[model samples]
Target: MIHSHVPVSDLREHIGRTVSVRGWVHTLRLQRAMQFVVVRDGTGLVQVTNRRDGGPLEALIEALTPESAVRITGRVVDAAQVRLGGLELVPETVEVLNPAATPLPIDDRTGPEQRLDWRYLDVRRRPAARLLFAVQTTLEQGMREYAYAQGATEMHTPKLMGTASESGAEVFELGYFGRSAYLAQSPQFFKQMAVAAGIEKVFEIGPVFRAEPSFTSRHATEFTGVDVELAWIDGVEDVMAFEERMLAHAIAKVADLHGEAVAEHFGVRITVPTTPFPRITMAEAQEILRSAGWDPSGTKEDLDPEGERSVSAHMREATGHEFVFITHYPVGLRPFYHMRAADDPGLTLSFDLLWNGLEVTTGAQREHRYDVLLAQAAEKGLRPEPMQDYLNAFRHGCPPHGGLGMGLARVLMVLLGLGSIREATFLFRGPNRLTP
Candidate 1:
């Protein structure tokens, strides 16, 4: 009977016992008298040594190559001189389950596009790739834990919509049955509907689609979105406060769990940010950017990428914090659903959260009054016929509510200091590339 394979990480517990280790060859070192094969399972790596005499074991070791999946039956032993876990596996039998092909398509020097073409191989060869997903899993878990503790219900809204969800120009249209259907751009309307139905506090982590053909480092055709909505808030500040606390809690958990691994793998230090992250109005942010030698005269209503980085840097210097929320955007720049400031009708109670010089989140207090919502939609040249159901939610009776939509990949990218969203995502989808 064949024994179940043990993970390389647990080999220390079974010292001196004959066990079967199943994994891929990490490295193969052949000398005149001995052969050393380093095997790697996802848990860890173990060195398997065999004598290079004229025997079948040596012949099998000679035939093995890097990344070849194999089942190695060996006895675990302590080796004080060895660097990897202070242990080694003495091979008694070998089984080559699957041998890798000669001449791999990717390596350390391979370009980004080709490496993405062969992403599975690239991830197996690079430790950072595995670490990246592991961090993502932990990050999501931390956020979910915080949300659940806060009495928030997790919901999964439909992705297919009867009409274009938002920004009609960027909607991906498809044929449904006999008419046209659109991919839900954001759960904005449905989340609001949940609030109207008395779900009070809710959140969703799901895929968001964008039809824009942007090829920027931060842009992607499809990505994961972390969304949250709350009802009966006193003002937009309540939303901001909730977000800051949620993020702080999540970051602290990540730091506790994967901080050291992140530092070792990506050279990034995870700092748990203080609550009530620094807040600055949009006009004030522009002023700060101008003072920092960045001319933003060409863009008044919105901040460009350079302007975001400049303001973030300024805030970091002034507040000793990496996160800053630029708030009170001009009404024209935001969507019609955002609530208008009572003191200034031209500005909306909205904000964009910047982390480490990147725009990671956009949130606002939504206009829940039915009459005001209709007028705002009309002013923006939006016909009420297409999104009538969304408008009807406010007509009956809805409490004051607000929410935010955060880009998950963008957060991960900034967290790991990766060059692009492509590097952060498991399988990136863009305009130019689609297959594996």
Candidate 2:
């Protein structure tokens, strides 16, 4: 059965009809004869007015307070004076469902740490903060939409692993019976296993655990990883291009859906990046950074935070692009699984996609040959004896495969121009932060 009552966001649709709306009181104004109350459902806000000379709502209006939960039935009318939509609700009845407590724990000017302590209340007060998740939803949906259209199979790899997912370091070790188990650092090996299992293209969006103690804005103990694996790839360039177009499609969808609202709310300009995002080799990037007066004393194989920013700035200025892919990282910097270039064996066929001066993704063409994979593992000083199961996939027969792991929060942070990854995360899980 369809009900007559609707959300405040759709109140504009039932402008001339009498309807019921329910939400928390966003702001309440008291007058001698008439009172104005603005209420917010997660969708949007609507203004409700109660005439003190009312029929049955005067006392109820008098009892209302900020954040009061209420169900209000009223006639929707045009009020040019009202700022929101030039329309307001003239209340015929008001029911205070739950009177809010006197003092809210957090407010508009609250610090990020304190606001995190009371995230539920904090999110309720700021509609823009709510919109961040909305944008995130659209961004993820866009990726799925593109992936499904490309005939990719959606997958969920296990979060608990019998062995370390990435290199042995930065893994969360826990008890599994009398033995030990580690949290899956990334869906890296399993995603490749799926590719070897004859699933051509597979993608998963799930939690990834890292035991890093760094408390930087970008570092988190647990975070959502967007993983993608594909079989029959030409080289690392194929994987880089796949991610480039995927992210471009996602950013375009975000711009199409919530561009205007996000612009107004977050004061950010959304631009869908053009296809074939600027690409530069890691050596080229380092040289460009050096040319830009960036000193890289100890950082020879990989880019530091400042170097990444410098290279991104160079790309942005040189080509007027917001994204740049730094490819061909040294073999020492990348994992053992990354395929080494045939000509230059010292460098791996790997890439990191930088968005607006921050690294958001790392991808490479995985070595699919079983013998080479084992040799690479041995070269990296890793134990391949325990990884016989993973090796079996390649030993039997495996196609040339490649994949990338992207940080979901970091993507949203860069897209929305937010201060930090934590600001973009829903309930941030840092080294120290654990609760609501």
Candidate 3:
């Protein structure tokens, strides 16, 4: 009987027991009368020793190459001489299921640019790539769990739409069966439609497309956007509270599961951000920058990359926190959907969640008045006829609702201090990258 169970790690308890193992050959070293091979089975790696006694075991060693699939019958041994993890396996028989081609062009030593060019090879490095995917899974699962518990229904919106959700400049236009079609930049309209449909609280985690030609570290053409919207919200502050809790839950869950791995691989000390993340208005942020001699010309309503960096540095020095919410965006800079303040129409009730100098989330209270929304659309040089369906929802019955669209990859990138959003994304689809 082939015992198809062997722990990937070489513990002392499994020694002297026969077992069957299947994995890819990670590395191999040969001596005069013995051979040492390291095999990886997804969970972890194990060292296997074989006696070169003019048999199939010796042939297997000679034929083995990096990434070749193989299965073996082995007796676990307490290998004191082996370098890896203090244990090894003595294989009695071996079978080479698949052989890899020679001369691998990419490996762990490949540089970042080349590794991105050959991502499949880069994934084989074992620790770095594996940790990234693991962290992603943990974060997603945690978000789903927390949102569901908070009475939020999960949503799946269409990627192709007849009209854009936000401003039209960043939209990717295409032909849809002979008619003009644009990829959805965000699920803003549809999520609000769910509110109109009486699904009071809803969230969506899906892909968003943008045609902006950007070479920045945090920008991507196609990205996963984590969105949440709710009805009966007083202001943007309520939305901010919900977001902080969601982010904290996800970070805590990841830390509970893989904190050690994260520390070892990424050197990130995971801190589930406490509720009530520090908040400052756009004007306040500018004042803080000006006091620090980093005057970010007041003409621009929003922070540029350098401005974001300076403000983030200021927050770090003053508050010892990596996250800061910049609130009260200028009405001219915000989209047509944002709600203008009752006391002051010049500033909209909006906020951008910045984590370590990068804008990861944009959220605000939306205008529920049909006439005001239509006028804003027209003022922004967009026709209101195409948005009739959305405007109609506001006309009949719409509660005070607001939401945010957050870049999942951008969050991961900043949390782990990664250089590019591409590094956090699996099979990144940028303007120039589309294939495997």
Candidate 3 collision pairs: none
Give the candidates in order of lDDT, highest first. 1, 2, 3
Worst 10 residues of 2 by lDDT: 1-10
* Backbone atom clashes (below 3 Å) for every candidate: 0, 0, 0
Would you list the clashing residue pairs of candidate 1? none
lDDT string, candidate 1, 1-436, tens digits: 5766799889999999899999899888999998999999888899998887799999999999889999999889999888989999998899999999866777789999999999998888788899999888888998899889889999999889999964587878899999999998888899999999999898999999889899999999889999999999999998889888888888888889889989999999999998879999999998997777877556665999988898999999999999999999999899999999999999999999999899999999999999999899999999999899899899888999999999999999988899999999888999997878
Query: What TM-score against the true fold does each predicted structure earn?
Result: 0.97, 0.95, 0.96
**Candidate 1 vs candidate 3, lDDT winner:** 1
lDDT of each: 0.91, 0.88, 0.85
Query: In candidate 3, what are the lDDT values of residues 113-219, reduced to their tens digit?
Result: 77778787678655778788889999999988889999999999889989765566789889999889999988899999899889989999999988888877788
Error of 1 at 16 (Å): 2.0
Q: Least accurate stretch of 10 residues (summed lDDT) in model 3?
A: 4-13
TM-score of 3: 0.96
| Segments in model 3 whose C-alpha atoms lie over 4 Å from true places | 10-12
For residue 23, give model 3's deviation from the true position in Å: 1.6
Error of 3 at 288 (Å): 0.9
Native-to-model Cα distance after best TM-score fit, residue 152 in candidate 1, in Å: 0.8
